[model samples]
Target: MGKSDAFKALIIGGSVGGLAAAHELRSIGAEVAVYERSVGRTQARGAGIVMQPEVEALLANLGLSARSVSVELRERQQLHIRGKAERYRAPQLMTAWDALYRALREPLDDVCYRLDSSLRHVRVEGHDVTAEFPDGHVAQGNFLVGADGIGSATRRLLDATSRPAYAGYVAWRGLEPESAVPEDLLDLLSGRFTFFESSGMQMLCYLVPGANGELEEGSRRVNWVWYVNLAEHDLPRLLAGRSGRQFEHFLPPGELRPEIVEEVTEQADASLAPQFAELVRLSDVFMQPVFDLPPGRILANHAALVGDAAGTVRPHTASGTSKAFGDAAGLAAAMEGWTPRHGLPLRRLEEWEAQRLSHLVRVSEIGIELATRSSLGVPQGDKFFASD
Candidate 1:
């Protein structure tokens, strides 16, 4: 599709990937519409995400600058095992997911974003795709993009074989402002990345500067995530109490297990150095499931899968958002002059799939290996960050 083609494209899901696709399509002169299931102005859900260079590059290509999101770029990461420090230098970033989403949604003006319009089904013919919403509304477009998510309606309507498989672990994550945090912990964590490891669990912590480049009240906050292994039978108790009260671990703006919170606090108090322990003591905690989806490529007439919708890798690599944005870029490039009638060039789609599959496979393999090693109390050493 050339710039003068005037094609209409419909993107399902209004998150990062969907918004990026919408922006990319609009840049190419295609009329675009985004259907998101969420209602108006709900905060972006999820914990802090590490946006690497590639992700930053993609956002820049979409006309989104780093200043829009208060990106915190780090040059060094410190690893602590049994209370000793081991440091490695690498280029990484820490930022809230909601902030990144808002940044991406800022530059789009021509795109029509429809909230609460969840996709009900998709009918793809030889030269066009029709998307049906649950409210009996139908949208027709020259092409359709499924940026929905792990449980995508487009994926389900297209390929019923692909399913998300649980990776047998869950993550507890949260953020706390600097004022709420203690001074000693602030000194150790304010300027760099840090990780603490122990048997059967691990904690990753880093400083995300406030929106104004200062760590003041209601501005800068420390982002933390704790990965814990869960047995199958214990899932219910962890998910909800017997009284139907949801067991809160990592979802922000919710209650946390007092006992679990105190246990983690105590662990930091006794097992960590003074600076690191204070970071934990002064911080609030949250938790979430750490699940991975099956690995495979989805082949459709005029649609393709990207990011977690295709497959999910564990966050230990912190590469999900990066992969999604990268996938969007590739799809935009591949379909530059293609259409539903002729379909995206088989070779080009295959190439995109190959690139995404190779990266995601490596990430999943490393996640499994690390999970096993962490379970066995094996030393990860400095090589963990080296692979990136």
Candidate 2:
């Protein structure tokens, strides 16, 4: 392929990482197209997502500036011991995952995003890559990026041996309207993110501006996530009874076991102070299983993986989005000024892979440690949030 030839870049997935990659590639003049399995305009599928400064920087780089996004910039994060109401603060931001995705998607005008097109297979030969879809459609690109997430089809095509391993826990998340919560609790949760921990279970709560960017009265919403230890065998059964529509992404509201729900409610009622109780009682709960994807490198001709497709860390550090953004930026930077025949700059891919894997390993370690330590009522050190 000639240098002047418009390079066709096919991005498999339209989530945060995939959309960011497409935008970055397009900004640099690549002919970009995204294939998302879900049909229709994407909305907040899961509960909430925390967008750290590093992740925000990538969004700004891709022209999806933070100013236009409706997210609660959490200047501080707090940790609350299970039986104690006292909390300590750390820095972060809280926002809905769907809101973030929509913010990124809105800025792209030239890119073609095809929804309902699930990837069936990727045929890679030399520098040419052909992505086949389940609908009997095929797209050929000079390069292919597998940003399809944890259960990535692109990863499957590139490295069939890769699979997600469970971390022996599940995370339940949900959003509650602020008005439903009492005044005192809203005051405590409104300004900062809060975390609560206990043996075998952990819960977090934070305020996010409502869909309209208002946290006042009935307009604001509070986001909550609960992580609980679960035996691997019981996961499918726990998730099975929910309606198929509700089970599409994370667990839907009010689907967890009544006993577990009652236990959590009772715990929050007893342990959390009046300020924290309102946030918990007003919470519209949802649950999800947490898993850790071990780090591994994928080296092949004309193909690559990024974000959760490459590996995943637990959400404790709130670094998943940042890691995905870093991967997108690094991969885009690696592909600069390259032709199809020349293939991906091997040295560049190597450097990008090394940097990404190192960061992921550190983040994963922190996540595992936090999962164990938070349960012990230990205060998280500030060093965990420092950049490598």
Candidate 3:
């Protein structure tokens, strides 16, 4: 819609995608309200994003400098199990999830964001849409945007058939303070992307802006992710947190069962390089079960899906964050051409869905291929070697 249009947007899930849609839509003159299920600030419970141009664009559009929250690396190195290392010149920017989330959220007005508000139902009547919350509050808008993450309630409400399929592996991730890292390990990992790979597993680490977006030498953090293959039956035990609660997606740091944590430590000591083993031992690690959700129809009448709500490609693509922001941009671009005078942007949404679905499919295929090549045991063919 144009700047002169009277557009009201109701957004579900106030995380990156939701907040991004808020920014993009607002720039085009839409009044936006974001509803988040979390009562307090939402933690991504993950770390380390390879900066993408689209992500940087979103930050730039918000008047934030990417350099303020990112660290630049000059090379990629692979540390072998036997201590031999292979290196390549590859420059990239890395940032922490907390840093990006904080930058995006800080500028959003408190009145436009609602916390402790879980979506109860979505009602669409003619050209208008309404979002009902558990508290019996209803919000009406010209359109509804679903920017929820992988286990999206909005996706369920729109297309019950689309669901996240467990990818038969889990990522053990952690962030260690630079000040706490051993001097030798710190010097070894400081300005390069380091990785180690073995049968059915891969581990990588890089520097990221630390607590509260601090980028100073001693204040930064080393972000690492280890993707390990596991049997489907073992998932239940691994996902069972210390409180005896079974988590569907991930266990926050310190929530992992003590025994599970011990097992992972032992595995690292036994199989990983000495440096990586020590890194794992020193950090408070967390676990995230990987899953892939293929794109279904992302638009239903005046309601639409963005980010993981539409599709979830594997993390191997390193495009999750970029994809989320891209969805918001794509949606905004589509809507920019239409106004309320033309009624609902059904045709416009269809065009956006077509373009987005094609991109999601391509990225998902690339992730599957990368997973197989990295020995994660995925059976996909070498359809492509590109990324989003």
**Highest lDDT: which candidate?**
3
TM-scores across all candidates? 0.83, 0.84, 0.94
Q: Could you report the Cα RMSD, in angstroms, for every candidate shown?
A: 5.5, 5.9, 4.4
lDDT of every model, 2 decimals? 0.67, 0.70, 0.85
TM-score of 3: 0.94
lDDT score, candidate 2: 0.70
Q: Write the per-residue lDDT of candidate 1 for residues 129-216, one digit (tens) a residue.
A: 8988988889998778888887777788878887766555566566777778767566666557777666656677776655334434
Clashes of each: 10, 7, 1
Worst 10 residues of 1 by lDDT: 379-388
Ranking by TM-score: 3, 2, 1
lDDT of 1: 0.67
What's the lDDT for residue 386 in model 2?
Answer: 13
Q: Assess the local accuracy of residue 185 in candidate 2 as a C-alpha lDDT between 0 and 100.
A: 64
Tens digits of per-residue lDDT, candidate 2, 43-127, equal: 3435667767766786677666554454454445455544345545565556667667766777775578899978998787777
Predicted structure 2: clash tally: 7
Ten residues in a row with the worst lDDT in model 2? 379-388
Best by TM-score: 3
Candidate 3 per-residue lDDT over residues 191-232, each given as its tens digit: 999999877788999999988899889999999999988766
